[model samples]
Target: MLPSTSILFLCFLCCLSPIVPTSLNLTLPHQHPDPEAVVEKLQWKLNVSLSRRQMLGNDGKGTSSGSPSSFSCLTGNPIDDCWRCDPNWASNRQRLADCGIGFGHAAMGGKGGQIYIVTDSSDPDPANPKPGTLRFAVIQEQPLWIIFSGDMMIKLRYELIVNSYKTIDGRGANVHVTGGGCITLQYVSNVIIHNIHVHHCYPAGNTNIRSSPTHLGWRTKSDGDGISIFGARNIWIDHCSLSYCTDGLIDAIMGSTAITISNSHFSHHNEVMLLGHSDGYVLDEGMQVTIAFNRFGEKLVQRMPRCRRGYIHVVNNDFTYWEMYAIGGSANPTINSQGNRYIAPADVYAKEVTKRVDTDEKDWTNWNWRTEGDILVNGAFFVPSGEGLGVLYAKASSVEPKSAGLIQQLTLNAGVFGDPRDSVSVGFSGGTTTSGSSTSNNGGGDYFGMIFGGSAAPPPPSLTITTALLSLLVIIILNSRHPLLYYIHPLLKHST
Candidate 1:
């Protein structure tokens, strides 16, 4: 054993460390607001917004179908049908703001913002984009709802750095971003990228690129991700077709949180989605992402996101094919796979959906990766890990699981739809709405749950917090009995 002096020195060093409070009882007087009351208020706010939209569409009439009076049967996919079938959908494109499901449900991308029309497809100068270009619309600091005037393939000279509060709406047009650098959302918030095709993104640049209207900085080589969410939050990417990117089609990294990638079709990609930056990046622990109602189809290999450390809610997506494992992660991410349809390839080697990258079985066994109500086809298997309990699984899941059979219907209209038609118009034969649609043709009540639903789990126990708290508590209890006791007493008092 070491001498008492050495023990005392070690204790002194421990005292210098920060003290973390336990169970935090962060609930001060009225701090612990009633959760139900908060939910009800939020529900009311959403209702009022929807009702106001209806009023505006109907010119004060009480018609739930908005204007034009012609109503189609609900598609049962609450998120897609919420605004897709509306006759005034083009006019009220902002209604998509209310359509997000999961952690990003609150991402009201450019809602209540002025509309900006992008008439130009050319990007001659990325640093100083013309007013009519997509780059210009995205760089503006103000909230903007951008719409393409016509179908066009935009080849970017550099990666498009999108600013906060921007919505790139690609409905009613076949907008393809290809053969160049794609979108990068760095340190921005509340961005919605919908109904666009993002493919063939090539790495470019070691030059100045304009991030915002005022700021232009030299950017290093960007990994050709179709969409890169870096240090950003509240991002909703919906109804986009992503394929053949140089890197991940969609990547959320560097503490990016509150994201939902839903109703998107991802195909012909190698590395698909990536969440968190690196294995050692503990800041990404706060990341919460929802991957829902997407089609992971055709020639996809691994990492339908390879998460690092985050709460990843993968639900209701149709994984039609994958050359390699579908979902992978390391650093103990909490992955909740629910009601998804995973169809493995005939390659016997790639039958499993889960991949614990470079981790030992003993270590990965404790990672929270759970599958609930998933339909695994073609010998597809998910190697579930962690505490396989209802509460633990519920904590990881963002929304309640629907029937696994509904996966086909949920992702039926997965990609960007050029035209709005009855579910049959999307090419499904004998298309029928879900049971809920029969009673609620008018999208009402619990609309938030349609896309981004479910409250997050309580905070996980922190090792640093626990260790420091125990050490500090001990030193305080043994005050003056130890040499290091007095050193941390002031810190203990401050913490308490």
Candidate 2:
């Protein structure tokens, strides 16, 4: 055995390790928030938002078609209309905390924290990040409202590991996270990612990375997912553009729940979004996600959220193209799809929007999958299965869904709407190709090119995967006999 001093030092560092779940912002596992109560709260918020929307479409029929009155900046998408239209949004960014309206509505990210401005756009040192860099901002122990100083593209050399109670707000700048491992929220909670572009993310790992100011641990190879949520809760991703990744654009698994993915754009990829891991991950049974007010656009193949055992709400979105099925699942998940537009491709065999992977008809017959007021065009269809789940949906779908006719208007500003200078596209997969009509039938360019272009600043990439997956897991094994190096910090230089 080592000396007493050496043993104490090892224990201290172990507590500071990112993998240890030592965060203070969340309650202990024994004192975990009640899942049923969380669902009830989400139901209340959605019902409240629905009650406020005078969803009198032009024809006064919500079941058929119509839209909100023309005299307002609001688009009937409760989340976007809450803050995107405000002229003073940049000044009162924190007010956005009150605008959340779904399972993640309780995620008050960085609301009580001080604002942290990221003025540096440099590639970060995974072990010793410099102050003012985006890496430094996210690794802090305290809550922080992080925003960019100007328009810039950040290509991270490592996977970005975000801490709890933080908000990465990219409202006014042309921010992009590309070229390396993208955002990873692991064993943390209460994070808000808004108004940025996340695409062309590649896998990165096999290095020592920092989490808190005092912790630096070895990392593993990451899946190139744009936003990877692993064992986290209370996450909100809104108003971002995502495309062209080696893996799923946004993947949440390993018991990650209470998530809201809204007002975003996804395109030019194979597997689009994944909500659960392999079908055998029983821990994911508690996962609950809200996919709302987004546009699943051109060149997407499948997995507009391939789910597993969990409760999923797919509401108020637009599905334009999918080479394969749009939504798929296994291991008995409750899917509540309401008030969305699905435009199937010309492929006759792919017209059906749902697929239950490997599960037989008899077994999946009782899984609660239903669609309410969804507009299926171009012969597209959703074959829903299952039996009575009124109680589950009552809390999930209390929000009277908006009309599908208003999808274009609601998702028109889905991505980074800006000028030519405000965006960038780089991917190993085929990208920059428009899958559907570029022009809108409504005279305004809101379709493929229909997606209005705009400029805002961006963040960078970071590594991701289970337990950090294949990479970080190896580190954990090695750390038993040989701990990570903390003394490497003095050699790394940074701003005062």
lDDT by residue (1-496, candidate 1, tens digit) is 3347656865775675555343222111111123223222323433344344445545644365544433232334557756876767888889999877667777878998999999999998877888899999999989999999999999998889899999999998999997656998877889999999999999887778887778887776777889888768889999998889998899887667878888888888899989988775555666778787888877788899899976787877778778879999998887876556666777899988889999999877667666655655656777776643333322223444333345565677787875331221122112221211121211211111222222334345244544444443443434333444434323112110
Clashes of 1: 5
Q: Which ten residues in a row have the lowest lDDT in candidate 1?
A: 433-442
lDDT of 2 at 483: 29
lDDT of 2 by residue, 325-414 (tens): 999999878676655667777789998889998999998877767665456666666776654222223333323333334556666678
- On a 0 to 100 scale, what is the lDDT of residue 341 in model 1? 64
lDDT of each: 0.69, 0.69
- Cα TM-score of candidate 1: 0.74
lDDT of 1: 0.69
Best prediction by TM-score: 1
> What's the lDDT of the predicted structure labeled candidate 2?
0.69
**Per-prediction TM-score, please?**
0.74, 0.72
